[model samples]
Target: MRLTRVTTAELDRLEFHAVRSGEHAKVAAQLLELANQVDAGSEISRAELFVRAGEQWEFTQEYERACAAYQRAIDDGAATVVDARALRAGALLHLDEIGQAYAEFERLEADEPSSLQTYLHVAESLYAHDDLAGAERWATEGARLFLDQVGDPYVDDLLQELLRIRFRIRADLGLAEDALDRCTDTD
Candidate 1:
């Protein structure tokens, strides 16, 4: 394929759009290449690029690549270190490193996550691992911290997802209707 140069600004915008559109996997390789092009002096941005790449891979179910990218970001001191770590932990869960993943989650909980997405990922990861109590704790806490007693359509949407997850978790714990939540009900 013939190559065309992509401006950094345009690249950044494309990355954001790709992620927002849930098509990040299509651009993950480009992001990884851009990350490699970053020099040591630009460590922060380099780390950020790696984190972005990792997120793309993570969302695409490419857990091994996600873990590697996140680790690179962490080792480079990415601005969103906590988020990267949380995502890395989730990817670790997918990798079946349960003991290490649980340890990482416990550690991050002490630090508290730095973003709403981190909270969501941790909660989702725990839920997937059948740690209902842990998932409920994180999801509820995420809602409390992020929703701010007000509603934005976007945050509300995220809130709805969390609520659905929590409902299932509660049911699983026998604290609610024992039948599994279809997760089909919507606001």
Candidate 2:
């Protein structure tokens, strides 16, 4: 479908699922090429093209190229706040700019409190840096937010992961009793 008539968010959703399932790389090249297509001398489409290319590069772990593409999108001002921040954060994380990635996630969380993914990323980064206490806090907050407020489609997956992380954090902090209590059934 032509981009002008098609919703960008819808296309982005499709691309997200494709990348998640590892099937979008080939289609991604085509999307990237189309991103540069200009209609009636407008640069809008070109900006979107770069953003999509950046997203594809990110999915493939080409961190530097992904960041460049995302930077182009920002310079073009075609990316929405949520998309831009998320992509930039992912690229920064891939590049091992953990502090920058954490800051990005913090900004995203402030704007979107229901963004479990950002919380999860923050927690994972903190954990990687051996900040178990901070990671535990983030993981607990994410689990509670998802389970209580959103009940999102990813709840089960997030919950399982949270459980694991919580256990690890507790164990590492020498709270084995607390950790075991959580892991066991209360019924």
Candidate 3:
């Protein structure tokens, strides 16, 4: 389908629907063609289009293309900076660029110190890299920060996940007894 003179909003809606319906490749091709045909005027909007393209590439497990798209979005200063960073980091990890992936996650964490999601991402990266000690440290820090917000259901869920990760990391490191003691003390 050739889309001509359609507003970006309209295109976004169509793309969303297409993705939801699993017509990702078709929609992705349309989006790429459209991106080349139109000038979005705003860097942010263009960046968003690139990010969307990256998402489509990711759905197809094209990590290299996804990383390229995400990097373009980042370079354009897209509004989804954190999300782009996280996705790019994940793509790098899948590509076996562990150091680069860790750097991206660290940058996200540094920018959003209070973000539970950032902490979780860092912990998960460490865990995936077999750095049990680093994973446990990050998970413990996340749990500590989340403890005060336990009344919030979402925070509670995050806290629980952090605790679970910490326990698992400790167990993997043969510090299960220490993990038990820490949990007991926290309770």
Better-scoring candidate (lDDT), 1 or 2: 1
lDDT computed for candidate 1: 0.75
Global fold similarity of model 1 (TM-score): 0.71
Better of 1 and 2 by TM-score: 1
- TM-score: which is higher, 1 or 3? 1
Off by over 4 Å in 2: 1-27, 33-55, 68-87, 129-131, 149-153, 176-187
| Each prediction's whole-model lDDT (CA) | 0.75, 0.65, 0.70
Give a tens-digit lDDT track for model 3, residues 1-187: 4333546577678678776898776676666665555554533365666677777877787889889887987887746523677668877877888889879877866775566765676677678878788788777877777677767887667667777777778878888465433653245
CA lDDT for candidate 3: 0.70
Cα lDDT of model 2 by residue, 155-185, tens digit: 6565666667766776787875554336422
Each prediction's TM-score versus the true structure: 0.71, 0.56, 0.61
Give stretches of model 3 more than 4 Å off. Answer: 1-56, 76-83, 177-187
Backbone clashes under 3 angstroms, per model? 0, 1, 0
Candidate 3 collision pairs: none
**lDDT over C-alpha atoms for residue 31 of model 3:** 60
Q: In candidate 1, which residue ranges exceed 4 Å CA deviation?
A: 1-26, 38-44, 59-62, 176-186
By summed lDDT, the worst window of 10 consecutive residues in model 3 runs over: 178-187
Kindly give the stretch of ten consecutive residues in candidate 2 with the minimal lDDT sum.
178-187
